[model samples]
Target chain A: MTAAGNHQASRSGRRLERAGIRDVAAAAGVSITTVSDALNGKGRLPDATRRHVREVANRLGYRPSAAARTLRTGRSGLIGLTVTTYGEEPFTFTEFAYFAEMARAATSAALARGYALVILPASSRHDVWSNVALDGTVVIDPSDHDPVVADLVRQGIPVVSDGRPAGNLPVHAWVDNDHEQAVLGILDHLADSGARRIGLLTGTSTDTYTRLSTTAYLNWCERVGQEPVYEAYPAHDPCAGAVAADRLLARPDRPDAVYGLFDPNGTDLLAAARRYGLRVPEDLLLVCCSERAAYATTEPPISTLSLKPGRIGTAVVQLLIDAIEGVGAGRPVAQVMPTDLIVRASSQRRSTRTTVSPPRSPEND
Target chain B: MTAAGNHQASRSGRRLERAGIRDVAAAAGVSITTVSDALNGKGRLPDATRRHVREVANRLGYRPSAAARTLRTGRSGLIGLTVTTYGEEPFTFTEFAYFAEMARAATSAALARGYALVILPASSRHDVWSNVALDGTVVIDPSDHDPVVADLVRQGIPVVSDGRPAGNLPVHAWVDNDHEQAVLGILDHLADSGARRIGLLTGTSTDTYTRLSTTAYLNWCERVGQEPVYEAYPAHDPCAGAVAADRLLARPDRPDAVYGLFDPNGTDLLAAARRYGLRVPEDLLLVCCSERAAYATTEPPISTLSLKPGRIGTAVVQLLIDAIEGVGAGRPVAQVMPTDLIVRASSQRRSTRTTVSPPRSPEND
Candidate 1:
């Protein structure tokens, strides 16, 4: 262990009461300003003097109070990550692969910049929101009239959202995939693979992701002169997804290809196809938006529309931190990240194609 | 919007500057103490008076300073959740099914009690740890001599871990599955299914979970007079798990059955089995520990040993909160949670099995 580690251990063991900054100043025979400047890397000081003050502080177990620091600096070095839900239950960030991956990347990015992410709920009690001093916030999917976002923005706190804001909601910045372009690309890919008609398994929620993807699907169906055939479910409910998949497949005029908007839709549709004895790619093509690595190893390897949540998460944190630190302060920045379509056996019709594209490396995503 | 929501929306829209408590008290025509008491549901205040004060404060968009409140009450509603990493990179809580599910449950449990979770790295810089005032902390897997846990404990902060502390490390409370019993049960289950030999895929890290599970496996092998055949790798790396799985199957003394200790091992092992032209449950029986729902929908529906992370997460948070609020002060508490084995097609022998156990409902866990 380093000397700092050893000093910390010894101090933790021997010290019965917390040490204050005054003790460090007195023991080191240095003024309070010198100690403060040395510890905070503020005013100029000699390297030897700074090291001597730090060593004395560490030896004395002198630690600053977070409350005092926050009050003094008007900064907490904390960023809020709001999990938005469309139902009564608060959104658990791990419910979907997209959220899980996004949160992981966000945490990494925040830590890289010496900030920590606090998990907050969009619909939590007002006290829950106000109990922590956050420099900025990253809301997953703000509602059309999300009161929490409105409140944060009103307080002049920089708020960056993972999904595009709905209605006239205000956010300092946002990072989101091109939902319309991604959906259109998937529909075209399915069509190119000999899909006569493509249906959609979408969410009933009005979040920007769901609403935009569903609208894109409908617009594409209209432009291509095919009637829209789709089923909507409460995406938060896992069983509802399976039941909705069954309903989509059970339709008398069931489309030959299906695109799902949520993470678990691919498996739900696969199970539903099994129930109806519909072979994938042969009878129906399947695709869904997911960040789960398990999909790559699934039987027949289901095709997935990768939202590149890691990139989005990293970008959101960078924007939020930039806003918090007064970098790029004027105009709110909205970045549109590209999506990846991981083509797999589930989406390819083996019997119809004369030329086949080689499998793309998963690392490209 | 309700009256409260409408007031908040209006206040946020019109207020150019933040409202102080003094302003709220003056506007409400009440003493500062009276306003505070009414807003906090304290003191001898009538229901009508309390309602009036809160309404006035809401209308004025008066939010108490978190730093001030924290200093005055000597408490912060923020709870720290430390994510420990064994490799160089910081642990991403969503990397595995166990962590993802555990964190989800922990977040829900904390929110239920009006607390929010803050994600912190176990190896984060000291300033990061001191930047937030946390009422308590929940360490996922503390090292044998984790300096962070020691420092937090020394500061009179209550810490509850999700895994048993190795060596003589101190923690306020801990919640962990009975690893020895769980591993023995799985090995015996495999034996009962007419397996001649069973191999193991485990991690090289010495965390309590891995240490206890691996020790149990070795002890079980010694008792049965069978040489232990296992492959150990750094579990944090996904590609390492795949390579390790392939190596285990390529061994000259490869066991007829294998149990993997990580979430991704099931799919990795299955893929390796295919390379060897082996059929699941016929050529090799396979099982892995996981909390993922995808395992049930795999090619042959892989069996899994579930650590019941949700239960452990809830239990850990409950214990930490109890310690923080002095629910059961003094004696530290240790909880042993139960594990569930979800038997699926991959772990069952088709031809050798004379009798079959009915499928257990997943909700029983």
Candidate 2:
């Protein structure tokens, strides 16, 4: 062990009290500002002086107070991840594979950029959003008039959202899939499978994802001279999804093929089909938007439109960090990531086609 | 709107800067300390004074600096949730349904109590752990003698782990399931269903969950006068589980029934059974520990030992918050939450028995 190692070991043995910044300044023979600048990588200081300050600080086991440093620099190094709740749950964080995967990626990306994420609920009643000294925020599925995003932006904190903000809600930067294009491509795929009509299982909320996808489905039906067969539910309610799936299947005007908009729709549709003794891809074709790999092993693996939440998460964080760090200027920085359609047994009609297309990779612009 | 709300709405409309505590004090005609004490519920302020100060603060849209508040109170209202990583991924956060459910519950519970969770990797470089101000930490499956725990405890931060610490690493509190009881119960359930031999699929890691479960299986075999049969693999690798499951079934002395210790082992073992052309519950019986509901819809739904991660998560956060707020000091606070076993088709011999027992609930003593 070198001097620093020996110093750390000796400090560990005492267990009396924590080392302070003053001890480091005295030991390194520099002022406290120089010590702060050296440790925080702020201000201009000679390389040798900075290294000496850091070495002395480490050897003395001086942990600069994160709270004090945050107060001084006015940057808490904390990012708030705000999720819109659909019910009594504080956050619909685990409602689907998409949110969980997206959150995981966002956490990883934020940490890599030297910031930690704080999970904040947009529906909390007790000033939850204002309590945290967040450098910025990532709002998932912001409503048309989300007061949290409005307040944060009003306070001059950069707000980046995962979904395109509904209505006129303002965000510093937004990231979303080309929902219209993804829906259109899926409709085309279903059409190629010789379907006369394509029904939709969608959410009742007016979030941009549900709105855009629903509009795309309607436009496609009009263009192809087919009637729309769909059911909308309050997506935040998990049980409501099953009811909606069954309702759609029970409709007398049910289409031959259907696309569900949420993650659990694949399983819900399959179970509903089983209940009615409907054979998938033969009597009724099936597809859903999902991020789960479990679809790969279902009874007859269901084809899924992958929103590529992993890419969206990574991109959202990169943009948020860039805006925080004053990078990526001269551009509005809105990103529309591509979606992947993993072809499986459920979506393809066996009588008409023997060849299946491979997983469609998103065309990044 | 009332005058206070109207004042807030008007300030928000102007879109200027946020009001500080001093602004609140000036507006409310009170001292800064009086405003702080009243808003923070500190000091012996009367109810009317508290209400007045809060009203003034809300009217001015005064948001206190969380950093300054943290320094003043020695609490950041932030808890650290540390996940042990398998490899390059920040966390095996998506590795299993258990982590996802547990994290969701923890986040909800934390938010309900006016604190937010920070997701931190257990293996981050650059002083990642100490860089954020944390009131406490929740460590998931911490290794014995973890330096992170040591350093954190040395600094007097309360840490509550989801799993029992492996070695001598000290945590302020811990919550876990009784692994031995859960394993023995599963083994007996299989034996009662006409199993001549039993096998085990477990992880190669030394995590207390894996170690304790495997030891219980060995001990049960010893007591029951049956030869031990088992296969161990690095549970973090998704592909390794398939190979391990196959090797266990392909053994010359393969057991009639198998109990897997990890989440994905049920699916992996089922696939391996298919390769061997063995039908479930007739040629073989299977059980695994998992929190996924998808197991219910598999081809022959698989039985699972639910660790009751929701309860554990809620308990972990309760203990952590209690410690953070200096509550529950005199009581013996180490918790052993109950586990629920959801019995499905895969673990039963349908031909031999027409009856099935309900879920086994743990006795909390």
User: What are the per-residue Cα lDDT tens digits for candidate 1 across B1-365?
Assistant: 44445444556756456787866776777778989999888899999999999999999889998988887887888899998864434564335667766777888788888788999978787788987888899998887889989989988899998889887778999989999999998898888777889999999988778889999999999999989999999987878999999999999999999999998899899888888878787789998998777788787888888888889888999999999999976478999988988888788876556333454544343
Per-residue C-alpha lDDT of model 1 across residues A1-365, encoded as one tens digit per residue: 85445545666656457776766776787777899999989899999999999999999877788877887788889999998754434554325666777777898899888999898878777788898899999998887888898989999999998888888778989989999999999999999999998999999987778889999999999999999999999987777898999999999999899999988889889888977878777899999988777777776678999999889999999999999999995588999999999998889996545223223223221
Q: Which candidate has the highest lDDT of all? A: 1
Q: Report residue A40 deviation for candidate 2 (angstroms).
A: 3.7
Q: Categorize the docking of model 2.
A: acceptable
lDDT against true structure, model 2: 0.82
- Per-residue error for B203 in candidate 2, Å, reads 1.7
* Per-residue accuracy of model 2 over B91-138 as CA lDDT, tens digit each: 563354777778778888998888889888787664666778898999
DockQ of 2: 0.38
Candidate 2 ranges with C-alpha deviation above 4 Å: A1-16, A41-48, A125-127, A250-254, A328-333, A350-356, A359-365, B1-16, B44-51, B328-333, B351-365
